[model samples]
Target: MTRPPLLEIQDLRTYFYSRAKEAFIRSVDGVSLAIAPGETLGVVGESGSGKSVTALSILGLVGGNPGVITGAVHFAGGNGASGPRNLLADLERYVSLTKHDGRIVAVAKDEPGWRAHVERALARVRGKQIAMIFQNPKSSLNPFVTVGQQISEAVRLHTGVTHASEAKERALGWLERVRMDSPRLRFDQYPDGLSGGMCQRAMIAMALASEPSLLIADEPTTGLDATIQSRIVALLAELKSEFGVTTLLITHDIRVVSRLADTVAVMYGATVMEHGPARDVLAPGVEPKHPYTSALLASLPSTQTNGRRHAVDGRLPVIRGEVVDTMNVPRGCRFHARCDRITDAIRARCMGEEPALATVAAGHRMRCHLHPGEARGG
Candidate 1:
């Protein structure tokens, strides 16, 4: 039987105003995604593709002027009393916008009112129902507090473990569960004392300690040694099997996504270009692929050809153009500028209008002119 999504993001648009450019930086524009219970959904894209912003928007953590102008993050992981709740409930009341040529030119937001409303809407949801392990564990973790204490606090806050001693014991257990060397000794150590890998493990332990229904891991393996990166991925894979926690993993590494994700969403220029089951979407020579997705997969170092590893001949294929600048996104398909598969027949449509995410196969969707006239919906 098919299960409903634990978290669903619909038409999520998070924009930030840049005074120097005097325009809205569309960090996340019209992003829609979903994660079913116990399924890992990996969002892969380049550095500026709005993966992190999408995760932050889900947690109501987007700060700055006119943040999160429009969106509906419907979470179905709440207690039975309330069936499902929109994390961005009543958001329209707090902000007004001025547009010129269909672009947001000015924004007037009641910052205080919006902040209060968001706080109220996410009061019992953020940490308890959806937890996040942010990038850069050293910075995310408190340097002043011991790792154990920090984890204990999260456990107490989310898990209803009121007793400090019990929480501390639970925290220690989690550290051990994450395979921390000398869990007892490491528990009292501050984040600064640990290696990058160890710190990441601590961060993971703390996030999992709360047993949140949905876990958002933003760039979980970034800024670590290659060996450590593999270990962290391995650990995460193990934990996913053990805990079966629904996760939204945001990263640029396709290898990591291939290993961990059941479904994949390929984002570019602040929007999803392709989304589907990982096996089909990441398969080499897969048909009906968006040009951006094909380019990304082609850039990989090596691939198995006929069940044997072969290095790509000559230099690796590089996407010819620079990453899309979200500040001044083009009129047509966001990827049309960099796309290499634009035939003369589709060139006009690719340059004139953005294609909707159209279903091209069972459980697969693509946003490209190549797959024209399919059902227009994610």
Candidate 2:
């Protein structure tokens, strides 16, 4: 029997609300995608294109008063004993404690064995089943704590290891796995002492210590030198194959996506403009259906026009005409303003109609009015 996709996100919109302005800043608007078991899905975009927000939304980190997240992030993987299970069906069970009116409240739902259910579900999933590697290792790691201690804490928390020695040994083993030299020596070192690359390796070691089924890597190579970046990406590729871990790689670097991702999703202005196999989407001599995707490709340093490198004309659009406010996104195609391929014939349609994500090729999806029919495989 075939297994279900590891993670499925549908109609996901994460909007940040400002009571004073009474507006919702759409950080991630109506994004949908899926990652199969052991498959890598790359989300690429400019700095403010909501790639990190999408990852945060999936991990249930986009909740609280500042942000309102709507949609489903169904992660289907657990223990592997009972096949895959939908972990998001009722997340309320994971809420053993919630704050109410500035007071902490313990809610057991007044049902039989409710607390047990919440504890069991919370322990079985989340950090144990799905792990995330955030960008900027220095920020992600606690400065006060030793790297080994942090990794040990995570291992102990997720694996329920009682002995500190056991956790330390496991942490040391993971440090070695990430190819950190002298794992034993670095185990007790503080984050301040390690270089950026070593810090990233430690972050990776901590993230993979739990052996999560789904690994969400958010710009794993950020703040690193070019040589170190290549090494980290190669390490991720090697580890993924070794552990059979499915990945959701979120990065602004298209080069990183092209190197590591099997499938790629191009994001612009809080939405995905195109998604397909990375080879077809980013390969040489291939034209993408979405104008936004094409513009991004043209902006790449590799793109050449008569021996000179090609660069995209025009500046990136500022949503809502303000630096802080991203709520007032333009109607219709978000890319129409900066699009180089727009024609007078379709200008009205591009400006007035919101295009749905349409299939333009086998396994390739594009959000554009120019391609409105069913997709055919190459």
Candidate 3:
């Protein structure tokens, strides 16, 4: 049998509840994704399209108290485990059996015994098995501490390098691996002391210091110049190959996804609009099945006139009306309000039934009403 994917997310729903429980902001709604070992999956979308939330949900980092997450995220390669299983599986059984980086761990958004499970899971995997490089190095890095100290801490913690000298040495080695110049000297400098590119490199060093199996890079090139962005992208590509790591790259830059991703998932209005191989779905000549995906590609500068850009008409619909209730989400199609292709007759039908993601071709799927006989409306 073919091995299960390294990670599998099924119908994930993450909603934020108001204090009185009177309202819900459905940040992530029915998002499903899967990634094989050593493969890269790129999630592309505009801001507030639930891309970050999806990543955070996977890591069990979505906030709590007011936030409630309900979903199944199955991860493989945990300790002696042979295949993937839900992280939210029976708490007691999961903790006793699922080991990651030499520790039994269970991480969930919210559940009984969730705190203990999440803390242990994070301690073992956050820096060791699953590393994350955030969008902003400044926010991620501690301004008061020297860069070397931070990197060394993670190296020592995850690798059991008890001696400070050895930890610093490992940190320096990681810095060099990320192609940061003069690694040893840069180690002692604080976050404020390094340039944007250098600081980002330092962040990468810290994240990679533990030799993680999976890396979550959330817009790692967000603030860098085009030149620096290209360098970072190249560096990530190199590291991914060297480490044989599975990567979940979240970004708004279609160019970056096209260049680095093996698979691309286009998300909008808190839902995935299209998913397929990066090369085939993002090819210049091919028209995407989903209107949102097409509009997004058309809006890119390279696809525009002169230096001007193409803009999608109207605005992204307020998902499920403006009520923010999961039960009250728009009557039929959530994206129909902004979809320019909706006809008067089709609009009436679409407004009554939500379209499920249907296969458009081999290895390609899209969520849209105009998919002809493949309509999954109910």
Task: Give lDDT per model, in order.
Answer: 0.87, 0.76, 0.75
Stretches of candidate 1 off by over 4 Å are 99-102, 284-288, 306-313, 373-378
Measured by TM-score, how close is model 3 to the native structure? 0.83
User: Poorest 10 consecutive residues of model 3 by lDDT?
Assistant: 318-327
Tens-place lDDT per residue, model 2, 1-378, is 044678888777666655664665678878988888988999998888888999887765655443323456777777666654543345444334345653222222323343344346545666788889988888789999999999998899888787999999999999999999999999999999998999999999998898888889999998899899999999998897788689999998888888888889998878888888887787656666577766666566653343322433653332222222246676778877777677899999989887888877777888887877474333
Best by lDDT: 1
Estimate the TM-score of every prediction: 0.95, 0.83, 0.83
Stretches of model 2 off by over 4 angstroms after superposition: 1-3, 80-123, 303-325, 375-378
Supply every candidate's count of residue pairs whose N, Cα or C atoms clash at under 3 angstroms: 0, 0, 1
lDDT digits (tens) for residues 131-215 of candidate 3: 8888878778999999999999889878879999999889999999999998888888899988888888999999888778778
How would you encode candidate 1's per-residue C-alpha lDDT over 170-287 as one tens digit per residue? Answer: 9999999899999999999999999999999999999989889999999999988999999999999999999899999999999899899999999999999888888778864454
The residue pairs found clashing in candidate 3 are 320-330
User: Ten residues in a row with the worst lDDT in model 2?
Assistant: 316-325
